[model samples]
Target: MRRLLLFLLFMVTTGAIAVFSVQNATAVSLRFLAWQSIQLPLGVLLVLVAVLALWIPYIASAGR
Candidate 1:
């Protein structure tokens, strides 16, 4: 039951992201101080950030 709940949660989150990406399909770039990034879709950037957020925690816990 817990696994099924998690699966449903994941599916809902994925669907939300998909709908958001489609609605906000605008190219953008990042600039910080003297550093800058190449243009990319806003949705791609959001997904990358989400992946990094998940990955960092997994790496930290594994190091313990």
Candidate 2:
């Protein structure tokens, strides 16, 4: 069933996030050029960066 498969995928993604966040419970700072970010949870920052990596290209191509 498609719904069952989707449900399982959701569960697996959440489980992965839980494990990753638990394992990477450290604070870190990020900087770029003249910009800087305050310390944030390592896992949280990584997830945001990963999402942006995928999102920026998609947005850039959306006009075509």
Candidate 3:
């Protein structure tokens, strides 16, 4: 029963994230340096940043 509740919670949270990502995807752009730019969905950028952040901590700690 507890596991089922947790699973439902996870599903709801993920669904919310998906909906938010889809909505924001169309309204984002990136600017780098002067006179350089590219357009991308916010969700893609966020996922890339998240992956980098998660990996950095693990990589840094691995050497210790």
Candidate 4:
């Protein structure tokens, strides 16, 4: 049951990403402070940020 739910969640996220990327094909750059990243699809950048948001908390909890 837990595994099935996780699998379903994964599938949904994958589908969402696919649709978002297809809908947002425009290239854009990201700049932070003095650094910048090359042009990338806005959908991909958003997904990467989402993954990082989830990952940071998980890593932070590992030391406790």
| TM-scores of the models, in the order given | 0.86, 0.63, 0.55, 0.69
**In lDDT terms, how accurate is model 1?**
0.93
Candidate 1: tens digits of C-alpha lDDT, residues 1-64: 9999999999999999999999999998888999988998999988998999989989999999
Backbone clashes, each candidate: 0, 0, 0, 0
* Higher-lDDT candidate of 1 and 3: 1
Clashing pairs in model 1, backbone N/Cα/C closer than 3 A: none
User: Best-fitting candidate, measured by lDDT?
Assistant: 1
Please list the C-alpha lDDT of all candidates, in the order they appear.
0.93, 0.89, 0.76, 0.91
Per-residue lDDT of 1-64 in model 4, one digit per residue for the tens? 9999999999999899889888989998889999999998888898888899889999999979
Candidates ranked by lDDT, best first? 1, 4, 2, 3
The sequence of per-residue lDDT tens digits that candidate 2 reaches over residues 28-49 is 9899999999999988887888
Q: Which candidate is the best by TM-score?
A: 1
TM-score for candidate 4: 0.69
The candidate with the higher TM-score, 1 or 4, is: 1
Stronger candidate by TM-score (1 vs 2)? 1
